[model samples]
Target: MSNLHARDYQPDRQGTLDGIRVLDLSRLFAGNVLTQLLGDFGAEVIKIEPPEGDTLRGWKTEGIETHWKIYARNKKSLCLSLRDPRAIEIIRKLVPSAQILVESFRPGVLEKMGLSPDALLALNPSLVVVRISGWGQDGPYAQRPGFGTVIEGVSGFAAINGFADREPVLPPMYLADGVAGLYGASAAMIALREAEMKGRGQVIDLSLLDPLFAILGPQAANYRLTGKVKPRTGSRSTNSAPRNVYRCSDGHYVSLSGSIQKMTERLFRAIGRAELIDDPRFRTNSDRLRHAEELDAIIGAFIGERTQQENVAFFEEAEVTIGPIYDTPQIMADPHVIAREVIADYPDPEMGHIPMHHVVPRFAQTPGSIRTPAPALGQHNRELLAEIGISPAAYDELKLAGVICGG
Candidate 1:
């Protein structure tokens, strides 16, 4: 029923990361995101899930595992009851053939399971182990559970978010997890490259707190310089002026940024208030920042007289930077989004076609492709075990002993 572009799975398509093998032992969002990135680029991502499956599989929409379906695409699932020593041995056996290993367990959990970074390195000397936690492995908070929500609150992202008078607003989505996952992917590739070239492996201590805090962009330096914490000013930049979301006549909102001098002047002219360009309160960037409230009132009044589309068109014609604040439906319906196939309907067994984002950072020569849909629990257990020379009898014995499960 949707008008979004449709795409088919290219299972045979090769990607830039072809031949790389990843053992994903992470449970939820952050690990899934990291492995998904590698999987998208044609890495053999073996999701080593517990018998209960990855926590993401339980995140359902209308009883459909939509989150898993999206993030777990191009990945193979192997279910095992990690409580058993045989299961740990199976993991150890698989490590020699795996280039990378990702785990999101709390600090010391892997070591408790007798699969410490040292032990893993002993088994596979060139294996790049990515240890993801809420905090660093040896930190004071390492023993505490490292959920993304807790990390987001601790990372100072919530502090500078939302309105000044209101309480700090934690991001509704998985901000800490998402940022950590992106960082982990890059770090994994770097470690993998080093292992390949130098024939040595290392452990990456990737914490949700570190990556999220690193992206706050010199907040510490700014605080030290000003002797103050930046107050939350919703939608308004602390550094730039004439930058805020204004409501249009039709009740739709549009974000306009006149951060630069020329753009502000052009915006004033487009609003038929060219004289305000030289107004003492609105002349320079600092002056405009000081009087942002009054400037916003003037701009808001002009914008409120027009619909979102009208304001966008007028500002575009005037060569000022402005765009509509789109909701999901609006984004899906936008001409440019459709043209670019930003969201495409891919074949889904239950939904017939489910819309998800395209592979990001597109390449010209060796572009990534969605090779397959999310696999069922333990779907690749037989095939994957075979790769490590586990025969059918041994696999059946392990399954009987409850070491392997699902599929």
Candidate 2:
């Protein structure tokens, strides 16, 4: 495999979001994703975990906290048992200095814990409070446990995801949580900008359900017009024909798309089947969609005769759009991925080196940097407490009383 781009932590590098502070009291994927984005852009993110740790820490591969390491980089951890009143007080003290606060608690849990948006906003009028849940804060299902899996099933994504003959399929990855995280990041930035301009804080009611549903793209309107539900067509496009993955002779796969008329003709010519372009069953996009099975059979046969690389080269030479379906190993070895440094290796104490994605949405002048590894649980307890005027004696007492733990 080609060497991955190697990078070292640059703790002093500044980003556009420098001086902004985020207090993250969220667990699992969505919250981490939001804070990670903020942290990458130079916000000082203080992850307030429970004594045990954020739930992401428990998601280990071969007993390594891979998920936590990736998501929690550029963050500081302050582990506290929030059930204890003292820990709650610590959060209240930190609120005055923090510009943003994020939590993924069920709708009323933060209110019950005495850290409601109103309370936090009162502490710092410019504080932006982001509440993430499975559903909206005041809906009928607001109190439901909002795991991403449940939201994925209900968001109508699974309904049209796989082959119609098989049962609906949930995504293999955290699709709901990932989408919500990206939405939350943008929403938080919007809210923060408003707060900065107006000196008034507000609460963001972010739900996994809403963001996931929004991205499904006019499903309700389509159903209204067609009076029919979309069927699960596996990799095939419902509106476009000749858009599917084809197997190669070498057991690899390549995805090909001929979504437009010119592209369909080009593809037909490339595959030495130019006559199919005018054939009654495959003349237009509508005709091809109606006979996609037969069309796929014809295209698949041509692709199946060649190896994946050969097919890719041949199609590119013929000016037809095509690409090999890449697994992780293939992705890591690709020269384009290497030169672009899409993934790079970073020094890690435990694993010696860990591969991580480069900072995203690169800016020309103020690019972000990874300044630190994921913190050991509670690694910043003393440092954070000291910032809030907690002396050594008080810090020791909090530890002794089990109000603080994990470092």
Candidate 3:
């Protein structure tokens, strides 16, 4: 349904970051997600990996072939072993031409590689350096290795995310890392915009913990102001009763929320329980909340007899707040999501037409694109080296010396 032609979809031409070049030296979820965000907005992102490649190359549960094919999309890849002098020399040659450098190693890894922010800035003072880390570049745990799961646990997000009666559990995905990457990318953009105005670049030290800690939001505020640590209350509205998921006939689930008296009455009327509106315990929201357990029993008894479609139709016609508990398959099959074009088909040389989620905050003019497939290890090593004016003989020599690899 998109009217734009592939030829006319010049990525950089649309986004404000039209001519920005990013040297991405990060890997795994956090760093990769950030680079993907920038790439989506028209920046030219060159992802650098070690010869063995990013560890995420094996992320897919199915197999390496599938994992590597999809995770590295929309960018060029260059595999270089930074420990080698030739590799360092090659990176140095790249610095002068780059507008930004995004790296996600432990605190001192870049300095050890002789490509610290200070050194890179010395070569190109206009370069913005974004360093992503679990604990940031300094502090007691700065050098410690961590992943999304660790941050989730430490940040107390896992503590308030499960059923009240059950032990706390981590969310089943890498939400912490993914969100951190998004925030990091946002910070990078702001810094870049400021640099363009001042004609001077700045460094962004983005800590995964910062975003993780900030996610607590109101809950943190509650604890700070009231000394109360919020506990998990699955599907239950904090302020009202009868605002939770309920089972319907045909083994389907439906969510209901009627916090206001009018909405509650509408819900009751929809279920043919208008008489309950006058009942003493159900007269007010406070009264209903006080006897929530009894109210849930009554609501459940009425809802359990109806099929999912029947309940959904009744609620829709009445305009009461209710919705289906959609699983992934259900979401994919939904006509609304389909009409919105919320999914993208990413093509790869190894795997044809891989489906991926669409980027959010769509641009009106220079919309970002997944134009190219994921790189295969060092697929762009020669091209990149050529851009840096490295002769073909030198490229071959570096490859032969194990400083770089060619896919």
Candidate 4:
């Protein structure tokens, strides 16, 4: 690798996770995202992978696995075969120094490898073991392998998404997995806090299905009250009026959200229809709901008359909530995106500029930064092994015997 990729950003400012160490025994998307979240905040994350590297590293964009480049930033890599006992021994040695361990293997894999929660805690009494699985660690569906798409379908996300006319949509994104990773990261923090206070650590049994379901925002409550599954309404929200995507004159689309009375008034005023605010059919939220289609048509027509940029400017001036349905390039070029510093580019010789999203939820005092680039397989083998007290000779022996993948 080049010097720029090898170099990591060391912020002069303090970070919230500066003293933390994490052992990431996960691959693909969800678990990897979780560790990256921690690492973004200055956690020393060591990713343990099998010899061949993470399965998702093969996934490509423009002939590059861009996902790995962004999500695995600020973390080190250690390639080791979990099938080997010495690998487990190496992990046990790491456990004592690590504050958190994240894993996404199927329910019984850890137990099979003799690295169950009990065994891990025995090695490090205060370790926060975060376990994320498809249906959780103990349920009937726990043993079966599943990914974000499968979980979305089973967890009712797909059921509530997309148009009623078409087959339920599996989101283009990894919806469930991303939600699960956030939930898992938050759970790990809570567990770490409690462990520090109580002088003991515990296992976090987080399910891929549950977190996505939990974030449905009153969908379950609505179901319980009505005893009916909410019908899908495409891009429109079932709970609100005049909430949908509308095409502009320029053939671009923009999303509008005039859900509340205040926002609806602003929208109406901007569209030169202030008189509609006092009309009986659009006075209140309930009244507007009854005439949602009519209101949507009015708004959509107004939007259709204008170019996307014109509508964007009008919404900005009117202070109504609106946004362009931007593609990747559009978003990257957006003014607000640039102003917020949403994307940061790093030095990459081949790619020229490696653009990735910056760390989120800005902190006034302890903000996170994009420090390191993604690691090559086993890039941190020697340095990480040294921290765990493995000698140079032992490392050579392990590599020679195929006990470790990278040394």
Q: Please give the RMSD to the true structure for each candidate, in Å.
A: 0.9, 1.0, 3.2, 2.9
Candidate 4 per-residue lDDT, tens place, 338-392, comes to: 7777876676655766777778879887788777788888999999899878899
Clashing pairs in 2: none
Segments in model 2 whose C-alpha atoms lie over 4 Å from true places: none
**Cα TM-score per model:** 0.99, 0.98, 0.90, 0.94
* lDDT sort, best first: 1, 2, 4, 3
Mark the regions of model 3 whose C-alpha exceeds 4 Å error after superposition: 1-16, 64-71, 239-241, 259-262, 275-290, 349-351
Rate residue 291 of model 3 by lDDT: 80
Please state the error at residue 193 of candidate 3 in Å.
1.0
Output the number of the lDDT-best candidate.
1
Model 3 over residues 1-407: C-alpha lDDT tens digits? 22211122232344556578899998788888888777766677888888878877867655545545544555789899888888888889998888889988888999988988889988988888999888888989898886778888888888888889998889897788888888988888888778778868878888788898897768767779989788687777667877988899889999998988899999889888898899888898888877877888888887799988888888989999888888977776667776666765554444445556665667776566655566778988888999988899988888898998856
Candidate 2 on 1-407: residue-level lDDT in tens? 13898889999988889999999999999999999998999999999999889999999999999999999999999999999999999999999999999999999999999998888888999999999999989989999999999999999999989998999999999999999999999999999899989998899999999999999988999999999998999999989999999999999999999988999999998878899988999999999999999999999999999999999999999888799999999998899988888899999888888989888878888888899999999999999999999999999999999999988
Instruction: State the lDDT of candidate 1 residue by residue for 52-156, as single tens digits.
Output: 999999999999999999999999999999999999998999999899999999888999999999999999999999999998898688889889899888999
Kindly report which residue stretches of model 1 are placed more than 4 angstroms away from their true locations once superposed: none
Candidate 1: C-alpha lDDT:
0.94
Query: How many clashes does the backbone of model 4 have?
Result: 0
**Which of 1 and 4 is the better model by TM-score?**
1
**Candidate 4 Cα errors over 4 Å, as ranges:** 1-8, 11-14
| Model 3 worst lDDT run, 10 consecutive residues | 1-10
Q: What local distance difference test score does each model get?
A: 0.94, 0.93, 0.79, 0.86
